[model samples]
Target: MRRRNLTLAALAAGGTLAMLPGAAAWSAEGSYPDKPLRLIVGFAPGGGADALTRIIAEGLSKQLGQQVIVENRPGADGVLAAQATSSAKPDGYTLLMGTNTAMVAAPTLRPTPPYDPFKAFTPISSAGQFSMFLVVPASLPAKSVNELLAMVAAKPGAYNSASSNSASELAMLQLLGERKVVNARYKGDMQAMTDLLGGQIHMMFTTGTLAPGFVKEGRIRALATLLPQRSALLPDVPTGGELGLGKLTITPWAGFFGPPGLPQAITDKLSQELQNTLKRPDVHAQLVQQGFEGYGMSPVKFAEFFRAQYEAFGATVRQHNVKFE
Candidate 1:
């Protein structure tokens, strides 16, 4: 009888031990994000990417019952922020507001390739897309895309154009196509826009979210946009296609990503909340005004989409014969 009792107790203890991992996992998942979370952005504060990210962060904060702070780690066309996120603890506390520039363009453009998009991070959900606007200083003599090209043709390297990310750089390259224009690289759009406003640079590919207000205020001149249709927010601005500069078009997108090895439960929780946040009527309205289209997808769907985009960007780079300098 004593032996049987001891055997029963040992079995019970073993059972509890067997359940601990699962129970601990459940507890972790259930009480997740007890503290504030950090959402990294690769752009300076007050720029289009930063502004749009803040909006989503606010929505996420409300949904998760914690602060979702936007921490800017701007540099290397968003690669710095992405690298930080990829190397962070896989606790779901640190996330990246990744852009096409970081995920597709910057890496593809670089000679060494910082990190593999497939292995560096786990895709959470897509944030949205932006319209690229060809903007110049209001004081610039050129009034249209054609005039800008003519100016570049007439005076080889007299004008310097700024680019903060690969999408912008590629668009400018395609537009100029062997025309000698000095390339001024910036860590973020706001800094580049500042230079343009100060006459440090003559022109740049600014985003729709950042351009409309400045253009309306006559602070900058918008020559064209890379949108399929004229942005409703900037209805007066024509698209690159309309200007017969269709090759200048490029699609810029943003999304959320977690450090690799993030727990599945945490991933699902964040993804569902993000999708909800994007669907909010208030959120949708504000995003539209900022020249963004809110988008969301499940982890699996976004992963597939990310892979497809990576390949497409590679093809674009090869086709353009773009070389890293």
Candidate 2:
């Protein structure tokens, strides 16, 4: 869908990807990546994003003939990692496994934004997309989306919903509307899911990558998904549209990015290799098994897609009057 298109229409409208200063020197280099490269992840280890990044990093290492180290720097709903990557050298050695949370939501939600999503980094390529699952502890009385909302309604602000990212946070707000419920923030899905299983929280909007196992094991109950249709990973769970939440469509996605001024040659090489890596039968199979749809785009197209998603998210945040500290 729209995320897969990489916002082509946005690119078509106007604006070019801005390259930071001091990139020309590295752009001309013949041989690049003479050493190991660091791939920064914005979430803690064992989460969906971290798992996906590791999968891609393995394949990327094989493609580039160099080690693609996965580093975790989780904080501020992933702003810490994004900011770290943005300030790093533009030599392509340091890269970010960016998510909509850091790339779009953090900047859109915060009053004094930490960084500009587009200007802080160079778009490398689209990584993949997944849907969010509205999940609750298995022991909860609710079996469907309506039932869960009813429980929250019975005791306003009594039930708490966890959100690890801005997109998930927005999804929760869209569903609740004027309903009173506590919105608890966490650094990553794993942390939130832990509390969800312990009966500490009532509900959350989590990804297929992380929800399927818990749902299958009877640890959590998935009431609905944010996708327009049922997810293959959680076929039994109804979609937001199926539950009369058609407007609750939020596509959770991940992509690759380099620090500002990343050389064009290195960016192109990485993007092409990422595309090739995603197309690999083994890599593709793994990502799918984890509830992710693997895909990639050129740097130019990614730039356009980035702009589109950034603007779209910002507009959504404003329309909802969503705020974050």
Candidate 3:
């Protein structure tokens, strides 16, 4: 009887041991992200992307009841962060704050991209969108698109429009190709803006966040915005859509992504938490203050949106014959 009892006890213990892994998996699913979450930004501190990520991270941390940290790994026009995120483990703890430049534009601009934008990462959600503005020196004669077009056409290669290597410049080049405008290219937006202010470059297509101060101080004049409607911050300026150039809409967008093959349960949890964070009033206000229009969509929806954007930008690149080193 003692021997029989010992055998039964051993069987019971073995059964419980067999179930431990399954039970732990269930527990992880139930409580999800009982650990810290890190969000990687491709730009350095003080930029628009950093500011927006910090605001979102705070709200997300509050929602998840876990510490959410924003890590800046700014380099390669956001490629560094994207590559890091791509190589990271497919765990919910690590996320990349993807920019249009790094995810969509860089693939086309680079001669040989390090990673495939679509294949390397899982799309989480879009944080927001902001329009790019056409800014020129205040002393320039042209006041509108038509006037600028006529001036450029009359002089042919006399006026130049500068832009950074990201989507902003690509969009500007596309619009110019569509309108047949001519000019030069610069290494980055800041350099282009410097030349624009110095009367060396005629104009530039830049984000509202970058151009607002100059526009406010009258150092540069904002001719048109590249969004569907006018911005609340700059109500007086007309959008490219309102000016019969709706195709010129080139809004800068930011979003969250994780390493590829992340578990579905983790992805769902992160998506729900992100949606909740974006809904916060304070988060919305902070994003707006940084010139970002708050927008959040489901992971599937965001994936569709991302693909559409890539195709649209790809078309623009092909039409304009844009190539970068």
Candidate 4:
């Protein structure tokens, strides 16, 4: 009778274990992404974010032996795509090709951002960084950032600045520097570039891709890059720090993030594959042609970099009192 009782007790415990939730499906190395994965981009097709995501996704697909699709959910400075990513299951099937604007600036620019940048996601690897430059109409005589600022200081509100985005707004505010400069806001880059080219707006902050082509064609001039160090992509243009404008630095980056709670194993695997993909000569050359330098970081390192950047951008955002309307 005692032996029978012991047998029944053991069977009961075994049955309970078998019936417990996820007990049958709790492998740490469970086959992940048996199906195709989705990479969400917060911009329209053919734009920088979309193009970059597709490039990375193509390589990722080859590495993983499964298709990694690029899906565009463009809106709200990447807020829509971020919301989608934050709400996805942490199973590593859905990922975000997030940008500095989507992750860092979104929270600061809006009263209630869709998702918290630091909490809602897990940083994987940084894709690349884009360099921003101070651009002026070709007709302007200011040959350097210092010369241009001196000109703005003298004329004050006489010269107008075309602020195409929030980052540009903050940098332009710093450029104003205890002085007056009329800030003309625009919803997109092309609109502002039109006015600058038409001689209506005298100065603007632009990215490497847009500024260099125009500067080379003699339509506009690049005074200084917003980076602290000069970009190899445009060696002739001095850095803002080198030009004594260190306070106006803005180094925008593109990176990957999975929803919070993503398995560490999956994150590690993805990060490794991504680093390998970025190092490929073909991939590196293509990204460089798109005005990007491949910058891949491991999960832990990317988290540290993300937090540091958050602190830096927060300080700048607070100082500028920048808000989107």
In model 4, which runs have C-alpha deviations exceeding 4 angstroms?
A: 1-33
lDDT of 4: 0.81
lDDT of 2 at 304: 85
lDDT of 3: 0.81
RMSD (Å) of each candidate, 1 decimal: 5.3, 11.0, 4.1, 4.8
Candidate 1: Cα lDDT at 273: 95
Error of 3 at 78 (Å): 2.2
Residue-wise C-alpha lDDT for candidate 3, range 261-297, written one tens digit per residue: 8767677778888988999999988877878776778
* Model 4 residue pairs with clashes: none
The collision pairs in model 3 are none
Model 2, position 281, has a per-residue lDDT of 87
Residues 119-162, candidate 2, lDDT per residue (tens digit)? 88999999978768989999899988888888788899788999
lDDT of each: 0.86, 0.84, 0.81, 0.81
Residue-wise lDDT of candidate 1 within 1-325, one digit each (tens)? Answer: 9999999999898678758756645656889989999999998998778988999999889889999989999888788999999999999899999988789987788888899888999999988778778999989989999999999999998989999777787778878987889888897788999999999999899877678889999999998887767887778889888888756535677899999998888998899999999998888888897889787999999998788777766766787686766
Best by TM-score: 4
Flag regions of model 1 displaced more than 4 Å.
1-34, 44-47, 75-77, 135-162, 174-204, 214-224, 228-230, 238-249, 285-291
* Best first by lDDT, ranked: 1, 2, 4, 3
**Deviating ranges (above 4 Å) for candidate 3:** 1-29, 178-188
- Quick one: ranking by TM-score, best first? 4, 3, 2, 1
In Å, residue 270's CA in model 1 sits off its true spot by: 1.3
